[model samples]
Target chain A: EPEVTQTPSHQVTQMGQEVILRCVPISNHLYFYWYRQILGQKVEFLVSFYNNEISEKSEIFDDQFSVERPDGSNFTLKIRSTKLEDSAMYFCASKFNTNTGELFFGEGSRLTVL
Target chain B: AQRVTQPEKLLSVFKGAPVELKCNYSYSGSPELFWYVQYSRQRLQLLLRHISRESIKGFTADLNKGETSFHLKKPFAQEEDSAMYYCALSGQGLTGGGNKLTFGTGTQLKVEL
Candidate 1:
């Protein structure tokens, strides 16, 4: 079965440095989302992308955060300057349609900021 | 704002015992709720949803609006049921904008022999 795939399963970056996490959602899926789970915290929604633009974002997804579907297949989340609090495991998920309400999730990329 | 609360951080039970993972949500509008499970080293997978109202893997959950809860329950827990379970809600409707999910802190269930 087709699944969402993420690159750089783990990334270590320094504070004030830029970081980018990449994801390739299921080919036929339309809606994509980025969620992050801080160590021992609940999974928090960052942003949701559909039809080429972000539809909604959480407060955590502030000025430093950006998302793009640069190509038909790749969805990426970039943080301009990493902070110690930014260390978390980010998961990418996709849905085939709006009605199903089931999201297929990727393995997740663990980002560590020091 | 939408928020999900999973009261228990961890739950331990013996094999063949009944299991219930508590989940509660605070949402103003009609809620769309779901249960997701993550096994050791595996990606999060949908276990069931309130909309479907169907049982999967011998587990079931009923949405109780009056109680503002959607708890996952299994009659006889198997050892393989050990996993982390999360309850989520999408307060927004499906059509207009991105349906971002608000998830609860997961409950780690350990089913031992």
Candidate 2:
């Protein structure tokens, strides 16, 4: 079966530095999302993307966070000036559309900020 | 606001024993609930959804609107059932903008032989 693929399974970066997490969603998926899980905490939705624009974002997804498809096959989440609080496992999910509501998630990108 | 709650963080059972992972949600409007499972070293995957009213791997969950709960149950547990299970809820509002899901803290099931 085709699964969502995430690049750089693990990322280590310094505080105040920037990091980019990339994901290639299922080829035919039209809606994408980014979620973050702080260690020992429930996963929180960051943002949702559709039609090349952001549809909705949580307060946690502030100026520091941005997502872009950049191309047909790649979806990337960029964190500018990361803080220790940004250290978490980021998961990328995609679905054919919101109505079906079946989300396919990637293996996850573990971001560590020192 | 929508919220999902899983009362237990860890549940252990011996093989052949029955297993239940409790999940409760709070939402005023109509809600959709789903169960997702993730085995060690594997990506998260959907287990079942309440809307389908189907059983997968002998596991089933019933949505009780009166109780605001959707608990997953299996008559017999297997060692392979050991995994992290998360309960999620989505408010499928008009236009699908409420497509985002609220997930529980997750329950780790340890099935021993």
TM-score of each: 0.97, 0.97
What is candidate 1's CA lDDT for residue A86?
A: 99
Error of 2 at B55 (Å): 0.6
| Residue clash pairs of candidate 1 | none
**Per-residue alpha-carbon lDDT of candidate 1 for residues A50-73, written as tens digits (9 for 90 to 100):** 899888888999999999999899
Q: How well does candidate 1 score on lDDT at residue B77?
A: 96
**Candidate 2 docking quality: incorrect, acceptable, medium or high:** medium
Reference-based lDDT, each prediction? 0.94, 0.92
Q: lDDT: which candidate is best?
A: 1
DockQ agreement of candidate 2 with the native complex: 0.61
Per-candidate interface DockQ score = 0.66, 0.61
Q: Which residue runs does candidate 2 get wrong by more than 4 Å?
A: B93-98
For residues B3-100, what per-residue lDDT tens digits would candidate 2 score against the true structure?
A: 99999999999999999999999998998899999999888899999999999999999999999999999999999999999999988533545388
Give residue B63's error in model 1 in angstroms.
0.5
| Residue-level lDDT tens digits of model 1 in B25-113 | 99999889999999999999999999899999999999999999999999999999999999999877445555888899999999999
lDDT of 2 by residue, A1-114 (tens): 989999889999999999999999999998889998999999898988888888888899999999999989999999999999999999999988787568999999999999
